[model samples]
Target: MAAKDDLGRVGEQRAAAYLSDRGYDVLDRNWRCPAGEVDIVASRAGLLCVVEVKTRTSLRFGHPFEALDDRKVRRLWHLAHAWIDAHPGRAVHSRVRLEAIGIIGPDPRSGMLEHLVDLR
Candidate 1:
């Protein structure tokens, strides 16, 4: 894989581990369709979370979360619904939420991880 792709995979793995540590049950990773892709799908406390993970090696470009703009957010929302539709057996009680996990630096093991919940 390309360096950037590998970095993103590492970041996603880190994000999954972080969520797991926090008591969230990770259901899926890299869930995709014609609409778009969701980095992670998890459930916790009756909330269905659709996660978008952004990873960067440095701040020279910008914070990883900066990539999730209005357009991207809309796409994520659609993707979340698509995921739900595809997985009818999954039960969601509270509601579906958009989340973002940002990783900065190459080593996700020690890199800075910022998780932003309920993105608009």
Candidate 2:
């Protein structure tokens, strides 16, 4: 369990860096409310991006993205709104958008990172 958690943390860190490099201002990370947790929340060019990151040590079961099912996506949406509610005025001039990231490798530090923007 610890190893899995460590990998997730590293993956999220990598995702955050990638976003920052692309000019996204990170607002929140691992934010949780009654609905669920949001992996990363950022703002870029008047768009508030809610990012969900999935990390896998291997593809033995499936690709990292395979873990994000419909239910998970729905939960992320709920969490995104909850985040907006929590941080007033942050979304006033920004549109909400969903983003996803998948990291795959034996070690998260050297993982292959793939990012998808504006997921419906």
Distance (Å) between predicted and true CA of 30, model 1? 0.6
Error of 1 at 51 (Å): 0.6
The Cα error of candidate 2 at residue 50, in Å, is 0.4
Instruction: Name the lDDT of candidate 1.
Output: 0.89
Candidate 2 positional error at 107, Å: 1.2
Candidate 2 lDDT over residue span 34-118, tens digit each:
7878999999888889999999988898987777788888888888888988989776644889999999998887988889886
The top-ranked prediction according to lDDT is 1
Q: Provide TM-scores for the models.
A: 0.96, 0.94
RMSD per prediction, one decimal?
0.9, 1.2
Worst 10 residues of 1 by lDDT: 85-94
**Over 4 Å off in model 2, which ranges?**
none
TM-score of decoy 2: 0.94
